[model samples]
Target: MTEPRTPKWRALADAVRRQIEDGTYPQGDALPQLKPAAEAAGVSYETMRAAYKALESEGLVRSVKRTGFLVLEAPGRRRVTRDTTVTRDPARGYIFPAAARPDEPWQVHGRPFRALVPAPAEVARHFGIEPGTETLRRRRVTSPAGEPPFQLVDTWISPAAVEDAPQVAEASTGPGGYLDRLEEAGHGPIGWEETIRARMPDREETQLLAISTAMPIVETTIVGTSAQTSRPIEVTIRVIPADRVELVSKLQRARTARWPVAPVKPT
Candidate 1:
């Protein structure tokens, strides 16, 4: 029997994977656009697109808007080490354990974007209001230089609570950040509850994080609730690409259980 022939898309993907591994296209480098790349490989545009999709699923490359496809380089070197714990300092303001981690050099994509915008459905639900209701949304993006932008943080504040704390809407919510301000304004002793979720990102999230739609994202909604009254002060939605972060949790045993009598063996 004659040997089976490899499919065009797989062949192209394998070739590109090899090139990426061999450093032909360095990390953060954009691969050729679809038309030229497909022509060069003597494959159809659809074949090239399929190959790229496969590579994306493998976490090897990603589609970036306006920049074309980009090499992810290596996950090991880019992987961010994280701990499942929140750290805060009254003197230091936002102790960023999330994105812009202290271990690696990072840059805030831009200054915090402060605006009073209609709440997203999820955010509105958290705020106990109808969807599209006006709310104060503060946005920030943090990432390492020369890498895909990751960790888009959107903080939706309870408008009523911040009436007296005008600084909450300011460009810079002074020391200890807005949380501290809210606490000082009678929302004191803020407690946190986090709901973690994983799913494929939407178009906006994909472009913001510079990842392909094929990749999943880890979304963490950290809610700051009033410790005394149990009312949420703010809801923070944090988004990070799933392939690049290593989440660590240090679990501890609370207590030991012992049987009162000897255990019986099953037949």
Candidate 2:
């Protein structure tokens, strides 16, 4: 007796999974379009969608609107570094990190807005200054290419840091950005304090982010400190979509766990 044949979509998904594992379809690469793939396979569009959906469920691929089934990421375990804007590279020193791989690189969504504005309460607290103090507010929207904007960053830079590094007040701070300039201005050995909060977005935030009011946002506040004088130098607040990214924190052991042996005298 003949055995039951595998479903067309199931067979297609299995084939794709093999191709993905063998590097035939690398990360950021797109699979064939649904209609075309279905026609080529002599199957319906729904069948093709099922195949792609199966791959998505297995973390082998993802469906992007206006884009075909694209490989989400490479085959490996990934970790995220949720530091302040300053990412340390061995060759580059401190630089702003990219949100996506080279194939789909991150881009500043539009021209950044910079001006001296009254400090937010949290920024004042971090800087140990009076609320409403004037500070340079640098605001920018950023996202991966062809993707909806995911983050809005507002960096509040103290006047003292700007005074030390005049370039920090300029439109461009060379390649390494303000952190490098800050370090050059005798603020070496910089440290960071990060805190996270969650709340519903207001009208402006919802419109700028293009997310629904029902969706909450993740607020990450990073305070950069001068290790020498132990003073806060910069305070950056990042508003991010809650579901888009993973935030990881490193845990350090204060003391090792110990277990006592049973008393010999009792025995």
Candidate 3:
């Protein structure tokens, strides 16, 4: 039996993927028009369009209406390490020690918006409250200096946790941010749990992140509990662009003494 030939679009997509991987179309480079690429690949215009769509789905390129397709930063190059440890400073609020560097100082522009909307099912569960229960919500977009936004965080706090500290609902929560305010309100975070997921962006997310709908995104849900009561005090949903950042987890194994060498046996 004769072997079946691969689909034209599939073959073209493979060729483009190779070029992207080999840095032929380096990051931020614009690809040729569909007609030109189609001629070069000796395929129909529709087939070339399919190939571009495939690249977009793979997150290798993005179509910008009139601007055509542009290469995206490869996943391997841009990484933002996230340490398991959560440290707090008297001057800075919550600090990710792994992400901080002296040369690239981080800048935060918080645009806090308050809402009394019903909590999402997952958020309600984390807060141990009934679904659709009204809660205080603060949405913030945080970014680093000279770069696009790092993440979008939507924090939901139980009314009891922020009753005494109304400032927590505002954009600027003094020096220590919301955690400090919560501490003063007698609901400090002693432990945290985070869940991470990867998926495509929604319409609003695409615009906010300045990315195409085809790009993948990382969604992290963080729950903070009180040290004294072990009750959930805060739940935050953070959305990060996959191309701009990477997540890392560090673990340290316990040390053990070396065992004595045994006599060698002939095989």
Candidate of highest TM-score: 1
Candidate 3 residue 64 C-alpha distance from true site, Å = 5.9
**Candidate 3: where are CA atoms >4 Å away?**
1-7, 10-45, 63-76, 80-82, 107-112, 255-267
- Per-residue CA lDDT of model 3 for 8-126, tens digit only, reads 99998999889988989898888889999999888899999999998988777878778898887653335556667776677877864343454567655545577888987988887
TM per model? 0.81, 0.60, 0.72
For residues 52-158, write the lDDT of model 2, one tens digit per residue: 88887665665556876777553232245554465566544655442344345666887988988898788888888888988888899987766667789999888
lDDT of the structure predicted as candidate 3: 0.77
Candidate numbers sorted by TM-score from highest down:
1, 3, 2
Clashing pairs in 2: none
Highest lDDT: which candidate? 1
User: In model 3, how large is the Cα lDDT of residue 150?
Assistant: 66
Clashes of each: 0, 0, 1
Residue 154 local lDDT, model 2: 92
Q: In model 3, where is the ten-residue run with the lowest total lDDT?
A: 253-262
Writing each residue's lDDT as its tens digit, candidate 1 over 212-238 gives 788888898888887655877699989
